[model samples]
Target chain A: MPEPLPDEGPPSDLVSDVFARDCTSRSAFEDVTAKWASLTLLALHEGGYRFNALRRRVEGVSEKMLSQTLQALERDGFLTREVVTAIPPRVEYALTPLGQRVAGRLRALADLLEEAAPEVERAREEHPGRAR
Target chain B: MPEPLPDEGPPSDLVSDVFARDCTSRSAFEDVTAKWASLTLLALHEGGYRFNALRRRVEGVSEKMLSQTLQALERDGFLTREVVTAIPPRVEYALTPLGQRVAGRLRALADLLEEAAPEVERAREEHPGRAR
Candidate 1:
């Protein structure tokens, strides 16, 4: 009877409000912020990578997880996956311009967290429940 | 006898490199980027909120998820929880200076996404898999 509901909320012209939970931006936000997705985006920001190489760059991500994350990022227009034809076909992933902008913000966040890691560790030590 | 293993990897004095699988900053980076944690931090950035208020502000967060997120943020020194004695005891949550700084970066990210939402929507529509 109705077009399949996309996730949640009534479709609105304004899809930019993430705090609303019903907005499409919220779904996009979740896609971007998903742990593996964020890391994959960051890894690709360095340059294009073939699938296995990208997975290696992210360290702990499994093949299945990295595949799914790349698919999702590609769907959201954050990246492009190209099939390079050679002796053997290879799939390479790279950030689109939009993705590069998004990765820049993520990089800033990562830089802050890296610099603050020691302070965070001190706080972890003082947490009431972390006595062990 | 040996000490307990954390979520993963070996302990290191250098905790700031998130790109390294063993660095503790990756764990902290995961903590900050987790969906609910990022939203909760942003909500608190506007001002403090009682637990219920925060749950409401975050839109769809379940009580249990909010509690866990708050606890983690508190442990990381990103926020504080205080009990106010009144007619009924109430707990309030607010970002610490550290959390404020983190939230500023997150806010910048959010702003970029919000502004870029239209283009992302266009990309989503044109994605090869979206022919449905």
Candidate 2:
């Protein structure tokens, strides 16, 4: 709640400064950058998917973890959960406009990391002593 | 270690496919997207900072966490640590070329989050039950 830059700009007061200890954006940052959150956002960015499909695409995400991740994304306005009352409750997850924008950036980062993975592997192999 | 896309293009074998359970890039993804790692990268992207200065800039990071984060980044080739054998043996952290590329993307994501933070706050307030 401490306004560091009072006269900065229009949204200065509500700005999400991760550097600020009390900034709500800190939680936002954590939520978006979390391991499952990143994968979930990337998967949703591709298209809407049912719970099981999403879980499959993400790979290795447990049922409970996926559920928690989706709920967090929904609460952040980055995802929408729709329930299609079928024989069994079929829930689908998709990204909102805001989520799309965020996911686009995340995808770019993911791509960069993917592209650089080779070099990173080399570095690890060369510096086996440093591998952790 | 499972080769999913054997017929893919060059570097496909080395690709950091996070979707792969045993991908080396999964560790890289985790390192770069980590909360302290993200902040540390952003901080170094600005300029080289001594250990104590970095701790101050990051805010709320413990001494141990900072050390561990630095080690991870360094091992991933995202950060270069130079030890200045002065009276107190000062160590400086800075971004390498790879680090710069990764940090640039992270900064963009951080900027996007900062811009969208107000809306996220509004969403949280509207759905107090969803706040977590």
- Stretches of candidate 1 off by over 4 Å are A1-15, B1-15, B130-132
Q: Chain A structural similarity (TM-score) per candidate?
A: 0.86, 0.85
Task: List TM-scores for all candidates, in order.
Answer: 0.87, 0.87
Candidate 1 residue pairs in backbone clash? none
Q: Is the docking of candidate 2 incorrect, acceptable, medium or high quality?
A: medium
> Candidate 1: which docking quality band?
medium
Q: List the RMSD of every prediction in angstroms.
A: 7.7, 5.2
Q: After superposition, how far is residue A47 of candidate 1 from its true place, in Å?
A: 1.1
What is the per-residue lDDT of model 2 for residues A24-82, given as tens digits with 9 covering 90 to 100?
A: 67778889998699989998999999999999999899999999988888888898889
Candidate 2 backbone collisions, by pair: none
Best by lDDT: 1
